[model samples]
Target: MSDHAPESGPRRRLRLRTLLLALPLAGLLLSLLLVLPLRWLAPVTSAFMIAVRLDDEAGRWPEYRWVPYEAISAQLALAVLAGEDQRFAEHHGFDTVEIERALSAADQGSKLRGASTISQQVAKNLFLWSGRSYVRKALEAWFTLLIEACWSKRRILEMHLNLAQYGPRTFGAEAAAQRFFGKPAWDLDAGEAARLAAVLPNPRLYRVEAPNATVRTRERHIRTQMRNLGGTGFLDRLSE
Candidate 1:
């Protein structure tokens, strides 16, 4: 008869250490690899836009244009930052204060609002799919850290402005500006930019050209936030 014995302390500890080290090492490699490509690669499209197109052929294909960061009106960028992420310039990748508030709110049975920062949104839009899966969120966090580490904050903001969905078939500031205001993105004024930012929360439900009462309210809120964030000064430190 053969007898089997459970592994003892030293061997078990060694195995544990290997596993602990392996996870972080693997994460480091993934981040480093992604960082290098992102430094020079301006992605023409994103996973979210592709996903939306695949499921719905009811509308025209989304309009998308890649404009340099400078080509976009600073107001539009500021509106989006104000509307979606006020702490965008301050936070590295995650916003723990908002995260904690969301958690506390959830625990209290309050309405759940997403606390995804702009960087996290960019990570999700560029590299991952939409939805509220913990698995997807974990991957998003990994990619967010990589993006924050590898790219300038301006690059992150610019990429986000060009990729986030503005309507059912509208992608990017340029497309949304043209579609809604009949002007290029660079020409977007404060009200136009605020309206666009208003639709960002739920583009399908809000129309920029014909905003509903709710959307109008949101637009007002975004405009107020934009002023609070100090207009164009928000991007001061976001350069290379």
Candidate 2:
């Protein structure tokens, strides 16, 4: 019983409510701080690469060599767009059509296929861990929005090319090019680019070094999609 009165219940509740309300805004501001600089500065490493390095199951160091967008071949970029997200240039960050289709499939008692857009994948690979948890998905969504708002479509795809896993040990187009094709990423032709993009679904299982029947089929499909997308001209949309 000092002169000061004890804290009132209503005031304590109001304080708690205010703190809870401010938390998400604070988190968003912090995320903006993290993503805005990446528009100009290329990431040195990604969360996925770090996870791979720390993984006990992964015996060796991952192969990741950063290459600027110019250093990577346009063929490879087009191939990735063809294989991963066909509507990449059209969408902002999320692909509503793909998500709706996936949800419809699940409602029909079919398996839910992955519907992540390139922007979402860039967010996940660059910033988050692998999981289906609501928290992870929420964070991914937040980062996806931040990235789309902060970086250009070109920067998003550039990050994807550098961060995506191409092989068990390979972590970028440059590494995949040097390891599999024995050439620099800049020299990769369409066929080579398509092959590399084909194994992206499950890189650890699908070998780019030795194309399985599935890999070959996907490679052919990607090449067809590339042609359907009007060849490398589709990539020009990234700048706009």
Candidate 3:
């Protein structure tokens, strides 16, 4: 009986170790097979469905459409770059300057500006559940590094454009273009592009056509930024 007890305890310990090792392996496998493919998954467009699940009441997930790095409108890309990440093409996964600035602002009790890069946003939107916790942030960083290491800058931007939240039941530039202007993505002009970029900060609060006074102000500012950045030419350089 004493010998059996010793053997049973050792076996239980070994089983626990095996289970712990298997857990991460399973997660890796699931990521490769399931989460990675989300880049190509059709956008979920049912407002009722999304409202039932997510806390955000105004954003919609659009069908997945992969716009080639070249086919995407340069003006639209430029607007996004100027509005979202001015140093997108140059930075790696993380932007330290922006991070430091945001941290300082947070400490000062000002607006809590997030320093999440497009890649980080992509990682969170595509793979992670939304939360404002240190654990979630660490995971976001890990996935952002993995994505940057595995994918090109162009690919990351392309994915972000296609998967990002636009409006309630609207996702992607193409979907938004069609919904807002009854036009294809390629047809969006600089003004239209700027409006889209403006709403990106908070799409639910801003309408494309009849935007509130604040949204109108933001759109105007984005347009001014776009002009200062040399418009489409800046986006052309992103590929370089």
Candidate 4:
């Protein structure tokens, strides 16, 4: 009996080691799969679009559109960078400073805000489901690292521009532009672009035509940020 117990303990320890080793290996394999040119697989963006539709039908809500990267107005990109993640181009995956700031703010009884960089957003959109949980956040971090390791900044930005929710049922800049003004995204003027970017923080509540006073206020703030960033020039940098 003593001999059998010792043998089983070694076996159990070995099993635990193997399982621990396999976990990251599996994750690596999955990450590789995500980055590979698997055109047949349903893209993360498309899946989210479907989810949005289902939510709307079920009386839950999601705002989204499918705008191409090229079709989107430059100001839209700039405004988002200015408002959401100024260090987007520079950061690899995470923004520790912003994370600390957000944590401190939350601790002070302020609104709990996200410190997700553009790369993080792209990863979340492409791979993970939307929710605020420790597990979800951990997965988001893992996927963000994978995406940054696998995809270029240009590709990440492209995916984000196309899939980000702009309004109720408006998923991308092109879709939002068409839905709101009957204009294509590329033709949107500076003010129009700024207004569209303003609603991104909470598109469901912010309408283009009859935006609440708060929306109007946010638009003005975004425009100011855009101007400070040199407007169109900052947007042009996204391409380079």
Q: Write the per-residue lDDT of candidate 2 for residues 39-102, one digit (tens) a residue.
A: 9897888898888888847466689999999999999999999999988888889999999999
lDDT of each: 0.86, 0.92, 0.73, 0.74
Clashes of 3: 4
Q: Which candidate is the best by lDDT?
A: 2
Preferred candidate (TM-score higher): 2 or 4 = 2
- Candidates in order, TM-scores: namely 0.85, 0.94, 0.80, 0.82
Better of 1 and 2 by TM-score: 2
lDDT of 4 at 136: 81
lDDT of 3 by residue, 140-216 (tens): 78778777766667777877777676676577888778888888788888888888878877776777777888877
Better of 1 and 3 by lDDT: 1
Query: On residues 53-134, what C-alpha lDDT tens digit does candidate 4 reach at each position?
Result: 6777575544445545667777677777877777777788899899999999999999988888987877776667777899
TM-score of 2: 0.94
**What's model 3's overall lDDT?**
0.73
A best-first ranking of the candidates according to their TM-score comes to: 2, 1, 4, 3
Per TM-score, the best of the predicted structures is: 2
With a 3 Å backbone cut-off (N, CA, C), the pairs that clash in candidate 1 are none
Clashes of each: 0, 0, 4, 5
lDDT (tens digit, per residue) of candidate 1 on 107-226: 999988899998898989887887888899899998888888888888999898999889877899999888888999999999999999998878888887788999999999998888
Q: Which portions of model 3 show Cα errors greater than 4 Å? A: 1-11, 34-66, 237-240
lDDT, model 3, position 222: 83
Give candidate 1's root-mean-square deviation (CA, Å): 4.2
Off by over 4 Å in 1: 1-31, 58-61
